[model samples]
Target chain A: MAEDHKMTYADPWMLPETKGFWEALNDGKLVIRTCNDCGRGHHFPRAMCPHCYSSNLEWKESDGTGTIYSFTAQQVKGGGKYVYAYVEIADRVRAITNIVDCDPDALQIGQKVKAAFRPSASGQNILVFTPA
Target chain B: MTAHDARLVGAYELPYRHAPDKSLAQMQAEAALGAVADAGLSLKDVDGFFCGGDTPGMGPMSLIEYLNITPRYVDSTETGGNSYVSHVARAARAIDAGLCDVALITLAGKPRTPAKGSRPMTDSNKPDQDFELTYHPTVPANYALAAQRHMYEYGTTSEQLAWIKVAASHHAQHNPHALLKDVVTVEDVVNSPMVASPLHRFDCCVITDGGGALILAKSEIAKRLNRPSVKILGTGEAVKHQGAGDIDLTWTAGKWAAEKAWKMSGCTPDQIQYASIYDSFTITVLLEIEDLGFCKPGHGGGFVAEGNLISGKGKLPFNTDGGGLCSNHPGNRGGMTKVIEAVRQLRGEAHPAVQVPDCALALAHGTGGSLGTRHGASTLILARED
Candidate 1:
């Protein structure tokens, strides 16, 4: 992705727990924690399985494709527009991301989308979504 | 053994709308004193304390030292806007267990005043901060996602959502303390500037500075307080997720909480005369009404559109104090206001213009956190003693 095309904002690359996820994004992969015990996947990576409370977890790469569970077009004061949405990934897990490369108003619920890495204001790669 | 055996003997709201001059502790003190007096008790009689707010920093200790009272039991459960209603259930449980006799639950904040550094209080270091904040989703935007999905799945319309604000404004016309007194039409709500898709500016809640307090006493102490006591029939609390994308957006924890409350209270949904639902957003009220069994899934939009939530015209009156949409929000969880209004309705003390006639049973429901990503729901049933 070109630097100019990237959305500028504070990135969470500094968080020790999520450093690996950010590193994966930089390597062109979208990853989440899949609990080994429960055999389920989750987002915003956690130390323990939220569903089963099992510390048995591993990092797994997602196919980076999902459906827009829901979304909103935020019209900024300076005439800028951004589409924010919750993308439902595997096993009903949802990830909050920005929808890019399309008109904000054109975004729809249940629309198919895939992840795209873009440079953040903090000079780190962050994951955003685009129409698949 | 049940909430029915306990009573909320006192209720008070600190000055609503604007209180820029007062510190958080000062507002809480005023509300706490007012509630203590309303219950015909003194500070010395308060044996338990429960409070939740972002301001004042130190949790129970700040209020405890500021108010200069020590209690044996303290609960500082800070679950978004549903904290106060959640406290009611916890307080009742403590009192019933004989761990504490007289308990005070309070909430206060000054979100409108920059001098107090209170701006829609939120923790900066929460686990979900990394992902959720990166998209720059405002509170309305988060909730708008749920609203959009509801429209797509259930064919709910923006006009239907507008009615929730319209009805709240209609009730606000009669509330002297309500911040927005001007009656608003459905057209006004829909025509308002869009904050996010599927939700207009009017569809969101107001930001203000205020505080509220409630005093709960054992039935014996409540009976001798020389004031009308509203019995806490039953209460329920639940959390579905901390951040979004796990659970079904169309359903809420209210489905489980309200059912638990009804079973414990021995009161059916049809028997509820009034409802004090948390109105952080118009869609919130709609989803809660459905989850609480007032109507079936996918029927909330039409149910609210039929004017069922209006003060007098509808069978189930809601947000009789103008609700958070038009009333005071104060940056705290809204459950306190809901409880206060339910008490007033059951006591026949609500403004005559908005009071439900012969209201015997009332339901106070609250939702906390982002409705799209994560949320908590609390339900409390209150009734008058015959």
Candidate 2:
């Protein structure tokens, strides 16, 4: 019975959209997310809100500036590893990010932080944060 | 306000017990008996059963069948780990709607303690099996992805995460029923062999075998039974996703539940006297504290490391009976113990050595999985009227 089942295969990381996002990051300029409409600031680039069902949303250049609303340390090892942080930009939106190149102990809550581009484990310029 | 209309008249939960080899039915029966006695009632007094959907223990109908409960109301509400306490609000509505008078909530059995791979195999019976579990990615691995992502995005350190173990173990030292009461250090958490990358042995919650139960009835039932009434002040729920792609991972849905719960209870985070957040892992609690608005976000690691979760001097007195991380975790029934702790504190019945003073409002938060993919979360507010 087991042999009758052909193994179905899939790759988790081969996303066309993610590849495009990474390409933008490599230029040290966060991508201007292109969506159907609703031109505005989209920090974590996405084609849809999954909310208003308004696929009509476009990404623009954010100041790359925000404040650390909350964060936690992860001890479990693997790439994509660093202190996870929630950055609040433009008053209401929060994006998940990694804070790097600083003392882990020194990062504080509500401290101003800004995002910068760096080559990520995925071989793309990913936006990382540092204390402002 | 008339006593008869209050949603919660009486509630009682027994001290948690560890009995790994025993069947779920037996534990439920024992806990049910204790709850009955606490309310000055008997099994005959109970008219309903509510439990998580797929616990190894008895389901509401199965418990009714095995225990001969014969209740008119039965709830097998399974969102995830918070299922039991979530039952409280539903049971109250059921009682208010005159479906039943007393709802007996019970959970039993041991899925955590090592027993030759008794882990509930992922449900692969569905046609979507190819999409869900055919890849051999287990729950821990799903959590591992979130953990790794958190590490990548935040630069949160091993020492800070290890502090969750260090701090939880400190609270466990005072809990007589805790499975691991010996205090551990950050080194112990770091050195422990990795279960999945970024998660060490101590970072993960220990598997435990235990049973807990609670009795819930209308406000009038409290006066009639002569038991102190700890009203079910508020309850709330939030859903993230059933699959990985839908999960945001770092920003939890549980805190959203807590926010609604606080609004429903008419209480603020600072007004809560004690908290029993479900601790499947230390990170879960850390995130919860922030999301619940107890501490500013990102401050959870530092808040926990600085002895802020301890009983006497911390900014908040938390999990005085040891949390699921240190206490017994019988799958989703972990919520029962959390509510029980709140009830005890509100009734001024906790072991005097560990009890909080004048505790009128208590909060219990439950989280089901890592980064909570398919996460089910609920926050319950219980209060004692002066």
Q: lDDT tens string, model 2, B1-386?
A: 11224434334443454465666676667777877778787899888778775444445666777788789988888876677768777787687778998888876655654445454554433322322342334455556555554555566676777877776787778878788898888899999876655667787776666666778877677668766777777778776662212235565777788877877777788988899887777677777887788877666767777667767768788877777777666643467777878887888887676688888888888876446236778888778856
Alpha carbon deviation, residue A73, candidate 1 (Å): 1.2
> Candidate 1 lDDT, tens digit per residue, B1-386?
35556689999987567887787788888889999998899989999999875537677998889889999999888778898999999999989889899999988877778453334533556787878887788888988988988999999999999889999998988888888988888899999988788899999988888878999999999978888998888888998773424757787888889988988888889999999999999999999999999999999998999677898898789989898988868664678899999999999999898999999999999999888777888999899876
lDDT of 1 at B366: 94
Error of 2 at B223 (Å): 1.5
User: Which regions of candidate 2 fall more than 4 Å away from where they truly are?
Assistant: A1-132, B1-21, B54-59, B112-128, B242-246, B370-372
TM-score of 1: 0.94
Q: Model 1 reproduces what portion of true contacts?
A: 0.74
How far does residue A77 in candidate 2 sit from its true spot (Å)? 16
Interface RMSD of each: 1.9, 9.7
Candidate 2 lDDT, tens digit per residue, A60-114?
A: 5556777775554433334222455556654445555566665544666678888
Model 1's CAPRI class?
medium
Looking at model 2 chain B, report the run of 10 residues with the lowest lDDT sum: B1-10
- DockQ for each of the predicted structures, in order? 0.63, 0.05
TM-score of each: 0.94, 0.71
